[model samples]
Target: MALLETLAVVFAVALVAAVAVYIKTKLFPLGDGEEIREDVAEYISMMVSVFYALVLGLCLVSVWDNRATADDRVQAEASALHQTYLLADALPAEQRGPVREAARSYAGHVVDVEWPLMAEREPLGDDGWTLLDRLRTAGELRGPGTTAQQIAAQEVLAQIGYVDDARRGREAAAEERLSVVLWAGLVIGGVLTVAFMFLFGLNRSSTHVILVMGLSGFIAFTVLLIHQLDTPFGDPLGVGPDPFTRYFRL
Candidate 1:
């Protein structure tokens, strides 16, 4: 099943369970009013809440780290592209325009074509790298440069290498999948926490308790929504690299 579908099923089951238990408890109050009075139940519920909070925090951090890493990689790649463009000045006059044109074309392809697809978690096609190879090869050093200049050129090219590798890593990071066990833990924990709330008569009045439940449910739903969108390259809330689009000058 799709991730969304699986999530839907989890929530459906949890909601049914919560409502069913709530109704049953209301309709037929335990004679002794002691369904969860035991110390063991209290301890277990507290431990579950703590574990859920930790897991939620960890998942949020992991997703945020992935996004931050991707953003940094893109920035580095752009910087390298810019440096490579500037390096065209070092090439012999006959090679300058072609190198510049190739760099521009590569950047344009990345911005116009690759960025959107990446935002949607799509793999970049082989063509981008093909263009990169052509561009890199376009500027051949015919004769030895002054040692310093040669070193500088090599440094710039090294930066280009970094950009290429980093971009690939960013793309791979976007495709990273959230662990299914974590999702299971979130769903189960949420249900148990909410159910525990119902078990205890926290709200003196039914209306207040129902209000709390609805509000809590909404919060849980929002967290789950973020989890769904954390892939940003995924369907719901993926971040696009359109920020670099204007450089295309196309």
Candidate 2:
């Protein structure tokens, strides 16, 4: 089974067990002297919390790297498109404006339409790329006249290739859903963190109140962090849309 499915099963079992134990303890009292060891519970909760923090730290680091990579790719793509647009001047005058216009239009599409879609983890279709191809074809690319013109054409072609590669990279990055294993770890870790709370029955009613509040807060915080990292675009903590906006004056 997939790791997620496995974790789901485990989590369900653990949750049921926890509820049963809680109910059973309330329904029937243990022997007068028999109860959980306080020191042992403290040690276990401390260890589990430390482990949870470590896992959370690692997850944050991974997500940060992914976010940085995506941002860098966007900047690189915008710069390449700008270079290609400027290079349009090398083309015959009749061809220059159209080529530059196409590049500009494509950039606008990226900023206005495609960028937002990407933020939402959506990919724009062939239409966007087709416009790029139109720009590429706009130039009357000739054979080896002066070595310079040939070199310029080669450079333009390279820029075109970069844009294509960058787009593919962006798409791949978007598709990079967090692995099922990591998700499994997250779920199991959460359950374990909470289970560790019940390792010892609460002595004072005040202690029970505090434990319940603390566990609820921790769970809420962890879940919010994960959600923000998961989207990497839509949430306040997500990667920004500066990539597209910076390119165009838009």
In model 2, where is the ten-residue run with the lowest total lDDT?
A: 139-148
Model 1 poorest ten-residue lDDT run: 240-249
Candidate 1's displacement at residue 153, Å, is 3.9
- Write candidate 2's Cα lDDT for 72-131 as tens digits: 777778888888888877755565688688888888877778767766888677878888
Q: Which lDDT values do the candidates have, in the order given?
A: 0.72, 0.73
Model 1 residue runs over 4 Å out of place are 1-38, 143-152, 214-218, 233-239, 246-250
Query: Number of clashes in every candidate structure?
Result: 1, 0
Model 2 spans > 4 angstroms off: 1-4, 8-38, 143-147, 198-215
**Which tens-of-lDDT digit does each residue in 1-250 have in candidate 1?**
5657767787898799899989988998888756655776688779978988887777777777777777777777777777777887876676678878887888888877877777666878798889888777765555786665576567556766876887787677778766675676677767777777655554358776776679578758757775765775555556555444544455
Model 2 TM-score relative to the real fold: 0.75
lDDT of 2 at 204: 94
